[model samples]
Every structure is written in structure tokens, then in C-alpha cells.
Target: MAYTDDEILAGLAEIINEETGLETDAVQLDKTFTDDLDIDSLSMMTIAVTAEEKFGVKIPDEEVKNLVTVNDAVTYIKNAQS
Candidate 1:
């Protein structure tokens, strides 16, 4: 069930949009979830949980912090799938 980066990005963007009401196009590779997107910790946690379920990957609590940017999360999930 591996996904290309574009597919992952689109799916992640959709998740972010659903959780935060953000436009899917606003989610870019370099956008920081907190600084750029203004995502609070609670939203981040929710996004992490949702992403885990959607991507079928276990994103540990501690590792969530390391996922600072959209690209960071995309890369982590891509690697986790492998």
C-alpha cells in the first residue's frame, strides 16, 4: 500500500483541511504546521491521530513533534509505509 509523494501530500492536505478547515491548496511541502498554518497542539494531536488512521501508519506521540512541516510529515509517513 505504498503511496507516491503527490498522493500522500494530497491525502495529508485533505486531512488537514478536514481538521482545521484550511484550504487543501494551502498545505505545501514547506509550510510549518504551527507557524505557518497556525495549528495548535490540540489540532496537531488530532491531525496526527487522523493521519495515522488514514495512512495506516503508527505515528508515535513523541515523533509527532518532529513532524514540524508538511514535508516532514509526508516524508515520515512515506518512510513508515515502507
Candidate 2:
């Protein structure tokens, strides 16, 4: 099923929480994965892989550069679902 942006964000929150051990509230749309979430390149790759598996959307490496913030990743997933 296709997901909305909010659903994508929530899924991402779960993934981030699992990977980073962060609180659900800490994974907000405005939070940057690198700066705010302290997600390094390796962690980001793991998140991206989890996201791909969960969302059933292929997020290519080239497209990963565009996902700087939580909102960016959610939007990318939503767009990909469409």
C-alpha cells in the first residue's frame, strides 16, 4: 500500500528509534539525520536499507544525498509510493 507523508515519518521514526535508540519524539520532521539525530554515514545506510525493506521502495544511493532531514526522507518515500 502507498503511504502518506505522516505515515512515512512515523515509520522512519520507528526505524531511527530502533537504530539510534532515540525517543519517538526526537525523530521529528525538522530534525536532520546527521546533525540532530547523530546518524553517521553508516547508520544512515542502515536506516535507508530498513526503510527500503519496510516501505518497499528502492532508495538509490544517488537519491540518498537528497534526504538530509527526516522530512526529506518522508517526502521521498511518499513520492516513490506514488
Candidate 3:
């Protein structure tokens, strides 16, 4: 299956909300996970694991560091689905 960037972003926002109690709208493309969302390392791991399961993508541990913003994660998952 494939997903659009908007779908990926919405899915990611839901995951982040579930993991952090943040509002879905608060998750924007340019928002940094750490600096903007205040997501700590532990929450990031949980989000990554959940996102992998939800999106059916293998987000390797090393690659997680590269996903700095919501756009980054959405783009990664969108590409992985291809």
C-alpha cells in the first residue's frame, strides 16, 4: 500500500498525540520533534516503533536520528512505502 504526504502527516500526528498527549494540530511539518514538540528520547523511540507498525515501514534506529521534523518522518515513511 502507498500513502500520501498528508496521510502520513495525519497518521504521524495521531501517533505523536497518542504517545505524548499533544493535539493533532500541534504537529506540523516544520516542527522539530525535540525542539518544537519537546519529545524526549524515550518518547521518540516509542513513536518510532508505533509508526513502523502503523505505516508498515522499517524505521531503522540509525535513521531515527535523521528524522528531525514531522516532514522528515512523513517523507521517510512515504518513501519507504514506495
Candidate 2 residue 82 Cα shift, in angstroms, is 3.7
Whole-model lDDT, model 2: 0.91
Report, for every candidate in turn, its global Cα lDDT versus the true structure: 0.93, 0.91, 0.94
Identify the runs in model 3 with alpha carbons over 4 angstroms from their true place: none
Off by over 4 Å in 2: none
* Model 1 error, position 54 (Å): 0.8
Ten consecutive residues with minimal summed lDDT in candidate 3? Answer: 73-82
State which candidate, 1 or 2, has the greater lDDT.
1
lDDT of 1 by residue, 5-53 (tens): 9999999999999988999999999999999999998899999999888
Give one clash count per candidate, in the order shown. 0, 0, 0
Question: What is candidate 2's TM-score against the reference?
Answer: 0.94
> Which candidate should be chosen as best, given lDDT against the real structure?
3
Measured with C-alpha atoms, the lDDT of residue 45 in candidate 3 is 90
Q: In candidate 2, which residue pairs get closer than 3 Å at backbone N, Cα or C atoms, i.e. clash?
A: none
lDDT of 3 by residue, 1-82 (tens): 8988999999999999999999999999999999999999889999999999999999999999999999999999998985
